[model samples]
Target: MIQLQSIVKQFKSKNGVFNAVDHVDIQVKKGEIHGVIGYSGAGKSTLIRCVNLLERPTSGKVIINGVDLTNASIEQLQQSRQKIGMIFQHFNLLKTATVYDNIAIPLKLLGYSRQDVEAKVTKYANIVGLSDKLASYPNQLSGGQKQRVAIARALSQEPEILLSDEATSALDPETTDSILDLLLEINEQLGITILLITHEMNVIQKICDYVYVLEKGKLVEHNTSIDLFTKPQHPTTQKFLNTISQRNLSDSLIEQLNLTGAVIRLTFVGESTGKPLIADVANHFNIQPNILAANIIELKNGIVGNIVVHINGTPSEINAITKYLTNNGVQIDMLGGTTNE
Candidate 1:
């Protein structure tokens, strides 16, 4: 239930005026986890900040639930912001305050009653699994525990939209997965709309329903997480996917192996991932398939598989095999080497 229209945020630098976030448009539906991904300095962090007018756009509309935040009055904007919660890459908690005080402080400042503040803190601390750590200060907790405190503090506001700005980047892989799982639970159980910006494709792969790919302050691609992962169109997007999937083989490795025949990259999505397509091809066609690299990933939608293989066969036999695989819902990309065309 959030829409950003023609968003542009420019900054003055020694080089002159530059758009940190160029003209971009984004729509995040209610109760869905939408992700914006880009490498460092890709303007993704700046883009998410514009959602809550934390960084006001140069010229664009920031609409939340049909209200144009760009045109909102000071009081209105403040009121609107209370409905939006944000967590940062670094767990921004008061170091001296105990977890209970850190979560209760925001509610206290919001004019919540002492009893109400205690209740909200208790409820959210339990939700984020920090009930036992309420007495511990930030230094006494692990990185994951600190983030849980941050999450509990944010949820204390009862926000409808949660903005996560690289929330898991600072944690280790195991801790990252646990934090992601917690976010997924918050989205599913609380029905909160989550808009997270991360450079990690693994994060997007795990929880995002839809994905927006940003590069150098512009929107390059947007699609369902399944479609984007299965068939990445942009080179930048492909590079990000490669980080986690390893779908492409290095040319040096390919050359060193001295592979023969047509080298093909086959992509399998959903049900096709379970089929014996390679075996079927070998049985039906007079071709020998030598698999080079294979990877299967599970996304929010389902499974996607990427297999690189070298097929040794005559022109007609290779063509027949390619056609057979294509007919069975396999996407084929010729990496290098001979093909029937």
Candidate 2:
């Protein structure tokens, strides 16, 4: 539903031009939750802001649905923006306004009648699980409830696209889960296309169907969550994946340790992964392998696991075992011990 091409955003400063976003291309399918993740100053917020023209790009195009947002008139842009809703890290609600009025603001702005606005705001509040909070003020509510009020306000517009800028960053883990679950329900139930901007991989892993990894304002990696988790290509992407996945060392790690007679790490995937591949390999090699440390990842579709083991066998025999395992489509790495985050 959204397409960005060669998108760049630069600001004039005392120094040379600063590119908050640099030639980033992202395509978010309709009704899919697309996540953009990066560390601070990585241009994640700039990229999302570019989607709805909150931050106009210095160069490149912003295409939403079929409209060319870059060159659209102010009125047209405002009209198009109504189709997209956004929420922020802070609740951004009027402190004196009741939850009902906070959610009713958008409806009132759009010129809805009092009865219609009341009915819609009540419905939205219920959707965000805040039917009882309509009478409460922002100061009287918890962090989660305030966010639910923000969500109710955002959704009150009946937007097709929802842009979340660190919506859960300010919440606790339990509250974060609730908010993520609500987003999931909105996507599954209402088919609202979501563009979630955050620095947390755990957030992406939890709900994002697809992800775009941004570093230094560049689109370094983009793929399905499962594919990226299983085989990370970019080094930055690998680091982020390791935060959630099990960390195992490779042949280089073992070599760095400088105490490897024979050491190999085995990776497990899918249903057969948890089974004993070690025992079978040992039987074939006529040697018992000493397992050091292991990590297991039960992903959305399947499990991607890793185990580090110290091999004690002849070079030719161990090589034969690695070949056998590789032939079976198992990933093997050499390591001394598990690497630290």
Which candidate has the highest lDDT of all? 1
lDDT (Cα atoms) of all candidates against the true structure: 0.92, 0.85
Per-model TM against the reference: 0.98, 0.90
Per-residue CA lDDT of candidate 2, range 1-341, in tens?
A: 89998999998899989988999998888999989999999999888999999999999999899898999999989988999999999989999999999999989988999999999998999999988888889999999999999998999889999999999999999999899999999989999999999988889878888889999999999998777776678998888867775556555756676643566767777754856778988777777877766777755345677777777666676678888888776787665433221
lDDT of 2 at 88: 91
- Measured over all alpha carbons after superposition, the RMSD of each candidate to the real structure, in angstroms, is 1.3, 3.6
Residue pairs in steric clash, candidate 1?
Answer: none
Q: What is the lDDT for 309 in model 2? A: 79
Judged by whole-model lDDT over C-alpha atoms, candidate 2 comes out at: 0.85
Q: What TM-score would candidate 2 get against the native?
A: 0.90
